[model samples]
Target chain A: MDVVLQQLRHTYAAPGLEARTVLMIDEWQATSGAQILLRGISGSGKTTLLNILAGLLPPTTGLVRCGGQSLYALPEDERDRLRATTIGYIFQMHHLAPTLSALENVEMPLVFGRKLNAGARRARAYELLDSVGLRDFHRHRPLQLSTGQRLRVAVARALAAQPALVLADEPTAALDAESSHAVMDLLQESCRRTGATLIVASHDPALATRFDRVVDLRNGALHEAETL
Target chain B: MYELKLAWRNLANRPVQTWVTLTVVALAVALAVTVIHLNEGLQRGIIRASDPFGVLVVGAQGSSQQLVLSTLLLQGLPVGNIDGHIFEELRDDPRVALAVPMAMGDNIGGARIVGTDEHFFDLRSSQQAAPAFQLAEGRIFAADFEAVLGSRAAVGLGLRIGDQFRPAHGVEPGLEGDEHAEVHTVVGILQPSGTPFDNAVLTTVNSVIAMHAEALAAPDASTTTDHAAGNDHAAADLVSAAETVSAAETVSAAETVSAAETVSAAETVSAAETVSAAETVSAAEAAHADDHAGDDSHAHASAGQVTAVLVAPVGFIEANQLWRDFYTGAEAQAVFPGRELGGLFDLLNQGQEILILVGYLAAVMAALTLFLAIYSATESRQHLLAILRGVGARRRTVMLVVLVETVLVAMLGALVGRLLGYGAAAAIAGEISRRSAIPVAIGWLPQVEPALWLLPLALGVLAGLLPAWQAYRVNVVEKLFPS
Candidate 1:
């Protein structure tokens, strides 16, 4: 079965600023395990499109079907609950609670998880931190860790709940060249191992080669679609 | 939980501010507590002082207040004598259990000298029904010439039993010589009764009589000595005249003196006559010098026609009849001691109430100062509150934390304040009472009724609620928000 999207469009307006309609994706169909990339330069509505798909924001006009449920059809709290449990987001700037350690940061998703035992939550958090290759740094807070280490911790936290789709927004933007390659490699390897679909929105050419297909947006509209 | 944790940390964070507020609250609460106790004690003391002597009596035309002052307080402008004959008559009555005649006026070293018979000691009483004057070392007066000293008088004058001290005959104290009378032996010293009588020197009825008699008679040897000392060379001339003149020649010279000299002497005589008629200067002087003398017999008789009597009937029925009879007969008034005391208390109670109200107001203002201190801390600790909220603490839990912390601080302040207040009162009570002449009593750690704690507790609750409410209103969502 395919997670479906048909005739998707969105309009955004800022006071005393011109309004714009974003033609995100029209009649797109993709299988559950298919990976996609949204390629865009700055201000091309990449994050905006991700927000709509994740149910963080409502679409002006759209029908999005995921696991046989309409994303926009539920109330705000229900939509939030669905997004929290079923979708994983990795933003450009990873927001880890400064007071909590690396392992605790990875445990964030499980905190909202259903009646899971403390042992289970702790074990999952440990497993994710280890998978992100920061097993020894589990007790270090975000400020104490390197930039790459913090991003890796954020990626581990995102996938801790085992969501079906992982949407990353420039996850390697803050890293050096070598750290960026390593983070992309870990993201692709982890997504492939879990069989979870990965969609990355980035201007970095390195990420284009990591994903199967890339779709580029120009001037709030789709300009090109390509299979790498 | 959230609020208490926040409150405790908040208070800890600003230790100086918390301490200052706590101190202010403590001091005020302590003051309030001490004042409340003192006022209550003073009221009780005054009431006790009032009822020591029973059934105070005065003239028919006199006010109850005047009667209280004249017969009991031994003060105020004096009225004409209530008749020594009537006094004698009253003493002779079969129904009369005890009669003590009080004659006042002369002051010795500024201390009042009361002249009365030995019955004055018998009639003397205390609020607790204890003997008002107990012999500390020796016996009461054995003869009319003997004297008894009050406790303070004995202590202040440095006199003991058997020590002789002269009783002055004039309104002025320390009037020495035969004009004043020789020092009488202090045969007895009365125990401290905490009454005005503590300062008085008790002499027999005769001593008072001798004092006034000296006033009417020629000047004696001591007065002559003092006058001689005061007039050095001038006195020697008088001594020579006394040596040279025969009794017959002196009499002839007195008869031939100038008309102006006679006129001036007549003026002095007229002034003396007016002075004697006022009764306080003369009779009080008489009463004070020798209390037992019969020289006031003529004056008492002349004043008897206008005087009224006080009769203490045996039972309630007789008492009621006496009141009715006095009111209806001869346009006289009879006042019950109990009712009069109540009226006096009622009048004085208003002033006492004002005093208490001011104290309460001061306490409230002090409490506000404490409240402000706590509130100021709450405002400064907003970030700390946010941190606590970010934890698993609930709003009510945070409120309780603030509540508990404030209550604890307030309680501490109250305890400290009370200790300070007690110490302050103890240190200065004597000077205050002596200077004011209002007769304040000093006691260490004066009794504080258990119920008084309610005031501090109430203040604590109020001071706590303000800070607790502030902590409760801390918005968790806003704290998590960037702005």
Candidate 2:
């Protein structure tokens, strides 16, 4: 789905402590099925902006509109439904549920989305696991898999529901150079095949050539960057 | 559906903690359910034991509970035997439908030698069609020294048809010098009644009375001939006639076994009657008529000495009339076995109720344990819960997962508790049967199951709420990528 952000702001609050503004944006938008890369250093609110776009965290000011619906303007349940069907999130770390197997981890979104029954869910999960080339290790738990393999399982999970927008935050942050390139290739290839709007947030400037547009976040403000 | 599957996988992964919580809940429920089933089955078994005793039991003037316990349930020594004529009086009473006398006090190898008439075997009371007791083999005892053993008594004492055993003076076995010299042959074996009576040894009432009279005369006699002559000359005549020509041996040793073997010449002449046992309308009447011929030395034998009388009046009004009349008398008291026994058991039921409350408290503790289990586990899974929320699972879905996990634990515990309850109840019933020598069976009391099952599940639901609330409020962005 196409995404729009208009004058959004959010602050972090803690008890008996300090409140800090973490994210502020005048406007940002990603066209439908476009591949975009967002680059930022640590504490630059890369995760907070993704959270707003995913309908997870409502910003303190302004609205994030996805598929012509202002996410925060709708009820919390409706926002949750939109997140299940339209937006897919990949965290900084490969956060597969430790108890679930690789295939089950891929099936998580489809299970909660309730768009398919058990048989269809398993078929889709098997297809995703096969595409990631971890079909043989699909029954393996998170603790049994190598870091690269777990990240691959997480990628398959993000696209399990065939969501319109795929947001990947530091999908290869903890990987070595070769493993990072391989994981990025697999993630980009899967998104391209599914025609999903891909937004990858990372501080890796070397990844600028992999996207159609590249932007950098510094001091909670967006900056256009020249593609490498 | 997705939420429950997730919850189940989560719990299944933590097998040790899940099993520990389930066992705690099961133990609490098992303890409580055993007490409940025990109390219910014991009371029901006790009541069922008394069903054959007719409407009212009249015995000596002492404890009415003891009278019922001893005469109806055959549990202990009677308060004291009422006058034998009282049984005779009740038998001929116009208001009485049936009056069978019970003479207890003697035992054969730990089995009570119940001195009663043929009517004791099969009571034709209005309660049911089938007789309470039936002869499994041989025939009912008629002449003195002929006895019928109960099913358990035959096996426990290792006696069969035509086998002989002497009666001990008291109700318990293993009393030295208390056994009668009279060797009563087992003429029959009764079918198991599943009551205390399954271990009884039944003989004629007159035989019991005559045996005791003969025992009473033995200490006073100067010689063996005098011992037999002083009680009843017919006894001496019969003992000598037996020794001289293998005549019927008269063994008047124990007080309750007085006339068990005191067969006179007339008894020898009626040996054909003893075999067929058809000559006697009831065994007691035949023994009285044939053995003692107008002998004044053994006045007790002629009059009879009975343990108790089972009285069933013609109607409800007649029952109350007979009960009141018996109550007015100073000699004995009449008790409706159920009402008298119910009052005693109600006190025990109150104790069971307290145990049920303790069971509920245990269930609450089990629920709290579940809460702690989920709460502490959720603390570590905040990251995981955030991921689930990030993957499009609603806050309510997360809450529901916790609820489903806890409730499933409770339901499984209840299922296991019910089986444990039955096992514990059977164990208790077995112990009671072993100690009392009575076959006590387990019974299901109505309206008692839901307490065993539903309460734990409800408590599980209640306990899951706080931990579920914790999961529901998890911050997706904060937990997923913690700073």
Best by TM-score: 2
lDDT of 2 at B433: 75
Query: To one decimal, what is the Cα RMSD in angstroms of model 2 from the true structure?
Result: 6.7
Please provide, for model 1 over A1-228, each residue's C-alpha lDDT reduced to its tens digit, 9 standing for 90 to 100. Answer: 236777788887669979888655677655676677788888788877776666665778889877678878976546545544667777666766565678876775565444256689889889988888999999998899988898999888778877777778888889888888887787777777777777788888777776777878776665447666
| TM-score of each prediction | 0.54, 0.87
lDDT of 2 by residue, A112-219 (tens): 788998999999999989988899998999999998888888888988888889999988887888888987897788778878889999988778888879989988
Local distance difference test, per candidate?
Answer: 0.59, 0.74
Residue ranges of candidate 2 with Cα displaced over 4 Å: A15-18, B125-128, B168-170, B173-180, B206-302, B437-439, B444-446
| lDDT at position B362, candidate 1 | 67
> What is model 2's DockQ versus the real complex?
0.71
* Candidate 1 Cα outliers beyond 4 Å, as residue runs: A1-228, B1-16, B23-35, B59-61, B73-81, B124-130, B167-182, B212-313, B321-334, B420-451, B476-483
**Per-prediction interface RMSD?**
7.8, 1.2
* TM-score for candidate 1, residues paired by index: 0.54
Least well predicted 10-residue stretch by lDDT in candidate 2 chain B: B241-250
Q: Provide the interface RMSD of candidate 2 in angstroms, 1 decimal place.
A: 1.2
